[model samples]
Target: MSISDQIERLATAKANIAAAIESKGVDVPEGASISDMAALVVKIPVFTEEEVFLAAHPVGSYFKTASKGDPGEIYGGRWELDPSLGAFRWRRIE
Candidate 1:
């Protein structure tokens, strides 16, 4: 993929994750990007195991694993960017 494509994918993943968290009633920082959230997740020492896993592989490794049909793919269901909203929304493929 081109650099632009990679960036778009990363942004899409971040937006999707942010939306998911908010759907669960968590208050994400206003306008905070995924990179910001990952930084916080990594520094905080009291995250759940799943949180740690997500934080540890926020981008590269996460996408790689997902492509390989691994846990990363299962964690967030599936996502697509919503251009109108300027963020990603999750959907179940099934």
Candidate 2:
């Protein structure tokens, strides 16, 4: 498929995923992309100790920890400042 077509398809998929997440009563953060919400919803096991540690905390909780001078690691992911949101968002590495 053409690049534009692929992008359009992806956008549609993201919208659908976002709807599903909302239907589940999970709050999708403002300014967060659907893909980000999907990542939060679906937990693919990477079989690591860190993953276990991360599974216990809810999304965005780690940002608070990091802000207190702790390491920037959040539930097995990392926190990066999203300038658009003017806040730190959890980013899971795949």
Candidate 3:
């Protein structure tokens, strides 16, 4: 199934989901819409990939790998620049 389909399935989850997100520093409340969660994944981050990795992974450094083609074809993909977003992110290639 598609990511949208999977998201539709998770739309039925409880408020604890929002609580979990908020606990991590995001201000979203338990009443936030499911689309909010979905958007978080696809949204263009305000920070650069190196910044994000530094913030999340601390000691770890992120490496950039050239796309063999359309990255969506790879099974386990790595971070690549989304020109539209101006940030690099881990996009799952199915």
| TM-scores for all predictions | 0.37, 0.38, 0.27
lDDT by residue (1-94, candidate 1, tens digit) is 9999999998898888877666655667988877777655543345577666566544433232113243535564343322234223322331
Clash number by candidate, in order? 0, 1, 0
Query: Candidate 3: where is the Cα deviation over 4 Å?
Result: 1-12, 41-94
lDDT of 3 by residue, 2-92 (tens): 9998877676464656656555566664556767765554433356654554455332234334543533233223434334343343333
Rank the models by TM-score, top first. Answer: 2, 1, 3
Taking the tens digit of each residue's C-alpha lDDT, what string does model 2 give over 12-35?
987777777777666667767865
Give per-residue lDDT, candidate 3, residue 91: 35
TM-score top scorer: 2
| Clashing residue pairs found in predicted model 2 | 54-75
- Full candidate order by lDDT, most accurate first: 2, 1, 3
Scored by Cα lDDT, where does model 2 land? 0.58
Query: How does residue 70 of candidate 3 score in lDDT?
Result: 35
Worst 10 residues of 1 by lDDT: 60-69
Better of 1 and 3 by lDDT: 1
Better of 1 and 2 by TM-score: 2
lDDT of 3 at 20: 60
* Backbone clashes (count) for model 2: 1
